[model samples]
Target: MPRRGGPPEVNAGSMADIAFLLLIFFLVTTTIETDAGLDRMLPPIEPPDQDVVIKQKNIFTVNINKNGQLLVEEELLDLRDLRARAVEFLDNGGDGTCNYCRGGKDASSSDNPTKAIISLKNDRETKYATYITVQNELVGAYNELRNREAQRLYGRNFTEMEAEFLNPETPASIRDDLKDKVKAVQDLFPQKLSEAETSASN
Candidate 1:
């Protein structure tokens, strides 16, 4: 159909350009989310081919019942007192085995730090909080000993030396030295927390 003098037909090519620009804008504005989880370092794999006998007297047993109760050495203990007791047990050098051990030679308790084993047992229904708290106290006892040894050897706290060793900004030479210091501290107070399964009665 012909009209008198029509203006002109609008070109449809520019519309495609507008739609492409909108697609680019949306792509630029989009964001992607990621899942997060707790960072826990797992223990090294150990072969069960070897068997070693652990003396009964040398073992300090900690039991957590389903009622969220702590029984250390068969005696119910308060959470506040567990750390000090653990310290005493670890520091005792009864058998003349640990020269650096400062533990009281209580005939009824562990013979030496080397022989002292902190055996933790928990029922299947035990509270996680109770088990975690006991574990924390035991670890704290070991750290306390390690820190003391580090101070004696390096004239600094264990944490300070460890920080320097792990710091990304630290010089390679200094970090290497700190690494040895950290190892020395850990060797002095070797963590011996052994976990065992237990019956509900315990």
Candidate 2:
């Protein structure tokens, strides 16, 4: 008769250490996906003392319903055409004051980039993806114009100049010049995106 030795006396002492090492290795080597979010500077809490009056033509209205449908300027619009439409509205240059604007001066569109305001409204149940898509399109419109102007003025893209300005290694003198150029471009085509309170579905 042979004595039973507790199932050969298996060792479990190092199992937890191995598992912890594997977990640490995975944490160090594996890539983690993070949810994307917009980088926006929120407005101040205090409302303006005086209400500013904006012209209807200067406002571009983009509405998203719970069904993910787009109603731009009170008409159903396709997603593909949203960027072009927004660009046109923002660059309309209806007024003769915008010297850098190359738009056709459409009277029904915006007065200029400075006066253009994109008012995005959505239903409470609107798809987040749809809202993000529209937001990207609006921001793209502003970027397009800014790039155009920067290229013409500085021989470099506006975003490129901005990147150089933000670089930590940039020299103080060069950074100062880049800062002015960046501000000039921004002042020319300020992004005036406004979001109204979400509305409930009818």
Clashing pairs in 1: 91-103, 92-103, 94-111
Q: Estimate each model's TM-score.
A: 0.71, 0.84
Q: lDDT tens string, model 1, 1-202?
A: 8676977878998999999999999999999886443223466898777888877888888888888788988899998999999999888877777788777777777787767799988888987677777788888898788888888887898877877888999999998888888988877776788888677663
- Give the Cα error of residue 195 in candidate 2, in Å: 1.5
- Candidate number of the best lDDT: 2
lDDT values of the candidates?
0.82, 0.90
lDDT for predicted candidate 1 compared with the true structure: 0.82
Name the regions of candidate 1 deviating beyond 4 angstroms: 1-51, 198-202
TM-score of 2: 0.84
